[model samples]
Target: MDTRRILRRTRTGACLLAAVALLTSGCSFGSTTRPVGSAAAAAEEVPALTPLPRSTPAALEPYYEQKPAWRDCGAPGFQCATLKAPLDYAEPSAGDVRLAVARKKATGPGKRLGSLLVNPGGPGGSAIGYLQAYAGVGYPAGVRARYDMVAVDPRGVARSEPVECLDGPAMDAYTRTDVTPDDAGEIDTLVAAYKKFAEGCGADAPKLLRHVSTVEAARDMDIVRAALGDWKLHYVGASYGTFLGATYAGLFPHRAGRLVLDGAVDPSLPARRLNLEQTAGFDTAFTAFAKDCVRQSDCPLGGRGTTPAQVGERLKAFFAGLDTRPVPTGDADGRNLTESLATMGVIAALYDESAWQQLREALTAAMREKDGAGLLVLADGYYERGAGADFSNLMFANAAVNCLDLPPAFDSPDEVRRALPDFRKASPVFGEGLAWASLNCAYWPVRATGEAQRIEAKGAAPIVVVGTTRDPATPYRWAEALAGQLSSARLLTYEGDGHTAYGRGSDCIDSAINAYLLDGTPPTDGKRCS
Candidate 1:
């Protein structure tokens, strides 16, 4: 999936509210909802929180007292395990955090190239889920035979001691927050809702919250590498995983083997730039969808005479309408299609081309049918709100990591108001609202612990950076930026659409990545594929 879409989807309104509830309840939710104090002031006042020292393999023995039951790879011959690590790395004596690990052994018709770890973005998406459902069974046979395919759910994510919040009814209410606030009162309501949600997360999962940062998760990957007996890490990271992998390369350059970062993120940008660029990206994808829809008989935004711009305007107007009146979804709670849910549905469609049809059906249902069931499904999928209205910790952890990675772009409501014009210029449909939404982390309780820094990883082996020309999430420029930044980076370009280029479709992209993993032959610098 496009890293931006994945991030935006996971950090949607409901998720943000949950994260806020998780982080800010004790600080007087009503009184202290301002941006974090200045870093200098914070540093002088609040001691820097240190991470615990790394534990050796021997240290992990006690935690691994019980062996996991190995199940069928579901792809003929793969094995899975539950690896345990300390929840509070600073205190190894504390309780354990379990990660679901999966591996498809090398077929071995060729020489073994060692393990190749793969992460399919989301920061919330399950790596094991992706492997079992797709990569493990569907990856090219040559590559599969030469390298052991491996995956691990990051800490605080699915199957990894997930951070849980909200019962069914509460979540139903949370998902319907109005994103396009019509007035000051509406905006206050939205902000209050976010505060409540974040407070909930703080209450529900305190220990897990502090340790879910990208840096911490990157550290966790090193532990997984040691347990797997790998001398160095050879990996493929998609979407947000690219950030995780890049952080690893930065922290342990010498340990980085052959790494491939696809659908790259410009780790150097702050949250505002990230959200603004992403808002533009959604516009690009929506424009593509609009054009295609106009050409089809079932086009919901009217026919050829109506331009994509007009379609976007219509959608925006629909969102504005929802601010006043939400469309009913027929669920028991009277679940309605609010502006936040509608925006999430649009963001979800940008991940894969196959979802465009679903988007069309959803838009049709919302605009004409006036039934929100279709849009609700799209929103639910984005939140990973499954059968019981239960949510995955993906959204929770996504915020925890993102909030710690950088300070919020906007320090106050005034800043967001000033940036709206530029944001809308970037993407008329999604700009203003998303630009406002991007201010969320500014209100996070914990001060940001990291800043944007360039990654050179000088001693690491050649690493591949892949970019798709028309990728909606992580834009093509970010790939170029990342490739240029890494000392040994090789740029692999996929001249296509969608999020990450490899495995989703293009053989040219997949083969180049496979060769790098199996034979340690990085693709020629500036290799372009279609």
Candidate 2:
């Protein structure tokens, strides 16, 4: 899945959602699309991973037991450290990979409760970025005061030895490639694109690519846990990070302690199942957006009497119109708004409902004024592409981790063709494009190192699995499935619109998580919050 963590910031802390919407608001809700592993996609499982890699084995204690040589990070209060983990745990004698870690010590007069590790779900999102940007400074004061906020950039994410794929110009072409192909020639073009992209990563970082699987990352986390002097791990993971934490729990049940898995993913499902469900989740989000939009003056899709189904049809028509004659975005680079880009701009807003109004405005611009600048900005934001054209390794790592965690969702266009009807049934608006996007890993150079399976984490402490009813990236059903699979799981339901629930302006979610973090008391099973 696309690394699901909404990026923490931009040049403006508010992000480009508003600016983009004001320009591209004419095409809201009805036509959201991103590659299957978009920024809000779910994140993994493996067999050697099942028994739980708990105690430091005799052969590897040397690496795990090594003390972190901490140093001040140029940031005032945080300390940074480097950790070492066996590149191949099964063959510890081969080599080691260096991991980046950071922490803000507890600022307390109260008794310290050790460290609380935080992951902001990308499978690619930088945990260190999350820690410094939000968790360290914005988390509940009590929690921060008593527990050091810690983070470790996964093996192939930012700050860690990153995985590099297509560079900027190449990426721009790849991103703009038509996902909803019209014919076999277009299908060949899409398949060629996937192969080119995957080939770039393999050629650029052959060794690292082979080692960045989810189980390996989870194992890396265990080493970080031991290096931090914590016998047990306390973590709060959102979206894809939820999958990571759950993986860790399965891999090391006895080491798990007080984990809050918001936007939970069902580890048991394969990529095809996960991708299909996520598409449905986006459709659910659009329905909510449409229901809200018709109530407003600038509703682009429909009016008071207009049904969501009609809104979807109108939006699809708009996308089709873009295919024949692209709109000028009025950008300095003269980038026109293509169907793929307009769809990406729409997908950008699905992560948070607060962006719904912006989406409406964006659609208005595209439909009424034929301006595409705003939509382009949203696409940039989703891709984490800065105005300067520099991109983080988020998408690269996202695909690397995701592709390794599960076999490709479909092997070829023929396979996707067979599956297209089912996908369309799931998401008439976005299904075809997403089905094509799923073909990305089919061309991956390395074979998958993990498989989808239930993670019981039987001996772990009470783990809280949070779900949002209208969550677009991680379907609410996945949360229910995950909660059911874990031996000791509590479901915290947020009946709202968005991706994950822990701190999206919800007092109910915050309080329950805080109580769990501080007192080791989880909210009762099936607790509902809005």
Candidate 3:
């Protein structure tokens, strides 16, 4: 079992796919000391939410009615604006959350369609960043000609009063936390790390932390829609963005015009079930990587005759070797490549097949040459820790939203201990740590505001849900589940590797999506792309 990509959905920002590598497996390290008592509590499950109406709440009317004042920002063609949304939806007057918005007008040859909002799916990911960086410039020219490409930095994300937990050095320490604790002392260290992380977030963004839930973010999107003067939402959301898009559709079905939820998440799953399934998905990806790795002459995992199991064993052995003695990397910061960092680097490579060659090369250097710099670089990329030691708000906001979305996956170390075998059953390479990683939210200062529920979004227009058969992060089955859960969803299958399918060299996927977005023609149900 490999739980390398446990919280893959939340590791998004900039080009979601580029950040994909940095979304490396989530874990923090420990000092190998025991605590007086276990830092665990009973899991709290929120009652499932019924769909909210499209009608804006009276208190929120001001937010939805306000027009944005757009100005030239970033690139010459791009414009940026600030929009306001209620910090707390239920009690709208409590406060306000400001969102950053960006758009590029249609370069039209013909008719203009409505505004098209795009989110790349880090609950932490910056949607406005995505629009300015890629979708605004790279989407099909015809689609761009018709639609004003738009995005909003949902509350608590970058340039939107972004959440901050740990500073760079502290985050470096946090990422090194021992996820796979071998003893009570290790467990205590892990608990301390989680406490430190949760406390940092609480101290840094007390008010905004509780206000950044996905439900609120979706509502913020609606406000952005109205501010942009779009009658309905024309949107494309990838990875966790799919969850936000689905939440929008589920909440405001009539306003859900045309949407593409790529690399979908199953809203029906419990946090634990979701984590376990994701662990298995990573294992599936590692198995694929291993099978592919052995076929290459320079693969460090195994030779051509080796089986995937053998390769995994060899890799596991390598990891065990590093657990005690971290390999030295040429990092000026003196950051040696620990087992956690190296494993994260490997997980980063699993997101894209194109990176497999690089992984092989990195592994060769780490295993044969005793040089850990390449893997350390990959690990840094995954964490979004820049060469200058500056950190993005990505992971901070990722933890904030995910912790609020569902109850902690594991309430206690005992609970994790009980679920350990099953997690390992899901992924031998990365299982135990992920099972422990799920305990992260247990120490969250804010109680969870949401829970598992089926989102049929009944009465919504046809929504296209794209699934890649071998997507490592958002698994293929999640897309299937999401499509089935949405009343008018049309499933488009890409039987391939990597994360999301569209715009990643799959013409079939791109064409189908383009047709839906442009002509309102959904691809055939269960349409398959190679």
Candidate 4:
């Protein structure tokens, strides 16, 4: 599945919901009452535990024993370091991959709680970027005061040995290629784009690409934990990071500490099912957006009382018109808004309700004023397109990690064609494009090394799994499924809209998670917050 930001920033930060066909990192709660009375009392009742004995293989002891000589990085109050991990765990003699790590020391009033690693998802999203932009500065003061905030860009991601694919111009072309093909020629162009992207990645880093799977990334986390002098890992992972966190817990159950998996992905799903479910999730989010849009004076969808399906029809018709007649976007690169870009523009805003007004204005500009600049901006944000030709390795790493984690969702156009009806049923507006998007991995250079399986993490400490009832990138069902699979997990529900719940103005979620991070107490399982 595609994964990126749990909390996307844009220009200063980046995107949230992964594009359909691309898996993304993206979570909810509300009663203000602290679950177990006071934080002080809860802190006093810290859980007793026996530390897990280090089981580092003799071949890999060097990596675990190494210490990072932290130094000042560009971002204030943050120290940066490079971590080394085995390129191939199966053969430690093989070269090494250097991971970029950053941290902000605890601002203490209470006893320090060791390092608390945070990953904002993106099978491709840069963990270091998330730490510096949001998690490091924006986390609750109580939690930040006690725990050293840390982040490591995963292998094949930004700051690490990033996996490069297409250059800026080529990537721009790829994004514009039509997904809803009307003819064989259009289909051929779409397929050619995917093949070129996969081929470019293989040519750039054949060896590195093979080793950037989730399993390897999880293993890297353990090495980081060891190097940081932490006995156990305390982490907050959102979106695809949830999958990574679950994988880590399963692999090193005893090393698992207080892990918060927000906007979780279900480890039990195959690639195709994951894509299908996410498409439906986008539709759910759009329905909510549409309902709200109709009540606004500037809404482009319709007047008050317009059914969501009717709004969707208007949008689909607009997209159809764009397929033949693209609109001017006033981009310096001369890039016009195509059907594909417009779709991405709309989807990006669905990640959080705060973006709805921006989307309304964007839609109004595009549909009513015939100016596509606003929608183009939204699309650019989703793709992490920066000034001129500059772009992050997010899409490249997104594809690399996703293609390796599970087999391709569809092997050929015929397979996707056959699956179209089910996908359309799941989401009439987004299904067709998303179904076509799922065909991306079919052109991967390397063979798949992993498969869909449940993560039990049997010996791990209590883990918290948070879900938003209407998260577009990661559906709520995924959280439920993951919680049921993990041996020691408590599912926290947010009856709300958006990609994730915590730190996005949810006091209940923040307090519960904060209490768990500071003390050893977890919210009661199945707690619902609104």
Instruction: Give the clash count for each candidate.
Output: 17, 21, 15, 20
Ranking by TM-score: 4, 3, 2, 1
Q: Which number leads on TM-score?
A: 4
| Worst ten in a row by lDDT for model 2 | 17-26
Q: Candidates' lDDT values, in order?
A: 0.71, 0.78, 0.78, 0.82
lDDT of 1: 0.71
lDDT of 3: 0.78
lDDT string for model 4 (355-441, tens) is 899899988888888889988988887787888868888888888888888888899988989999987887788878888888888
lDDT measured at residue 423 in model 3 versus the true structure, 0 to 100: 79
Highest lDDT: which candidate?
A: 4
Of the pair 1 and 2, which is ahead by TM-score?
2
By descending lDDT, how would the candidates be arranged? Answer: 4, 3, 2, 1
Off by over 4 Å in 4: 1-54
Give a tens-digit lDDT track for model 1, residues 193-257: 66666676678787777777777778778777877778899898887778889889877787899
lDDT of 2 at 200: 88
Candidate 2 regions exceeding 4 Å error are: 1-49
Per-residue lDDT of candidate 3, residues 341-397 (tens digit): 888888878777777888999999999999999888777766767765787887788
